[model samples]
Target: MSSISIRKAVLSDLETLLELEQGVIKAERPLDPFLGKGELNYYNIPEMISNKNTHLLVAIVNNEVVASGYVRVENSKIYHKNVKHGYIGFMFVKENFRGQRISNLILDSLKNWAKENSLKELRLDVYSNNTGAIKAYERFGFTKSLVNMRTEI
Candidate 1:
């Protein structure tokens, strides 16, 4: 494993981020009912990286983004206790980059950012079927605090 540098994403990294997002969507298609057939909007990359309340982190290998994750501050009535909390989302590590501890580094970067922003808690929602991701979060000290159900209309 080469040295993987994790950094905050900028507008210049949009294209690479979009590619990463698409890769994750494709990988999850078999297990995720919400992921349908379509390409992700590459134009939204700028917004995703620059959103004032969001933190986008990327792991770069040889100047290319191979892994990415995001943290957003949202006000929630229940899980957040009506206060601002950090929510992790859009986490992805390129297939070839797995087992290198890159995801853990990205997560640590996000957690550091959350702490710097004075967030009291961090939360995330993983698909019930994504046991791998659930286990990863569990290893990071995340507990099952809530159960969510969905109804397809």
Candidate 2:
């Protein structure tokens, strides 16, 4: 395994991040027609990187981004009990980079950043169908807390 360096993402990394996000959508949610499309504007690399409440981390191997993840801070009165809660999202690693422990490195960096910012707890929403992600999160001490449901109008 080559040395993997985790670092905070910068504006210069926007293009690479966009490609990685598209790759993840295609790989992880192939059945969804909107996977690689511009359906969810929030995933836009430039916007996400510039968002004050979001922290993006990238894992580089041989000076190339092999994995990435982010934590988005959601300010809401509903989370008053945990005033500084962060929502983890968009975790992805290139297919060839799997099994290299890159994900762990990226996650560790994100957690460290959260700690520095005085965050109390981290939360995320995973599709029930993504068992692999669920298992991975469990390994990092994340457990199922609540199940959310939605209906299309």
Indicate which candidate wins on lDDT. 1
After superposition of all CA atoms, the RMSD between model 1 and the true structure is 2.1
Cα error, candidate 2, residue 72 (Å): 1.9
lDDT digits (tens) for residues 1-153 of candidate 2: 688898888988888888887776666565343344554434877777888778988888898987889988777467478856888887989988898767777778888888888887888888777788788889988999878666556
Stretches > 4 Å off in candidate 1: 40-43, 78-82
Question: Which candidate ranks first by TM-score, i.e. highest?
Answer: 1
Model 1 weakest lDDT span, ten residues long: 34-43
Candidate 2 residue 116 C-alpha distance from true site, Å: 0.7
